[model samples]
Target: MRYVISFIWAFMLTQMVNFVLNSLGGGSPYMFWSGVALAVIITATIAIFDVMLKHPDEENEAQHNH
Candidate 1:
């Protein structure tokens, strides 16, 4: 489902962040975990925004109100 896909994307993003940091000589043992935490925060925020913004009945209400 969407949750699974989100997790996959988060992990991949974490990997890429770690790789980039390492290339720039900024890598640390905790950097990967930090990236993961950041990814989770961002993903959760997006998910919440999606839920709040995607109301199927909103369009109907807008049509009636005008």
Candidate 2:
């Protein structure tokens, strides 16, 4: 479920970047780079949030395993 949400966020961000670039008459290479940057930023943000907001059960399991 987290993976799905991340994918959705990345996709939406990429599309938004593409749209803005297209409206400004950006070239293909520019659009590609914009999309890549957005993807990276989104992925990193999601990872940070996931780490900060861990599930209760996952935390318990980690403690037990350790």
Candidate 3:
């Protein structure tokens, strides 16, 4: 579910950038591949951050520290 959302968000972001580029007469010939690459990178980055930041024992650790 999160993956799907992340892909959609990344793809739409790429589309918006492409739209801007096209309007500026600087569009890429590899829009589809570029979008895919951006989506993969964004999704992997989100996943990595989620794993690194979301610990189930965070509250316990905080309590122990206090």
The whole-model lDDT of each prediction reads 0.77, 0.78, 0.79
Q: Which candidate achieves the best lDDT against the true structure?
A: 3
The residue pairs in collision within model 1 are none
Q: Order candidates by TM-score, high to low.
A: 3, 1, 2
Using TM-score as the measure, name the better of candidate 2 and candidate 3.
3
Q: How close is candidate 2 to the true structure, as a TM-score?
A: 0.55
Best by TM-score: 3
Tell me the deviation in Å of residue 36 in model 1: 1.5
Against the true structure, what is every candidate's RMSD?
Answer: 5.6, 4.0, 5.4
Question: Candidate 1's C-alpha lDDT?
Answer: 0.77
In candidate 1, what are the lDDT values of residues 1-66, reduced to their tens digit?
Answer: 886688779878877877787778855454667778777887887789877897889878978999
TM-score of each: 0.63, 0.55, 0.66
Question: Residue 57 in candidate 3 has what lDDT?
Answer: 97
* Candidate 2: clashing pairs of residues: none
lDDT of 1 at 39: 75
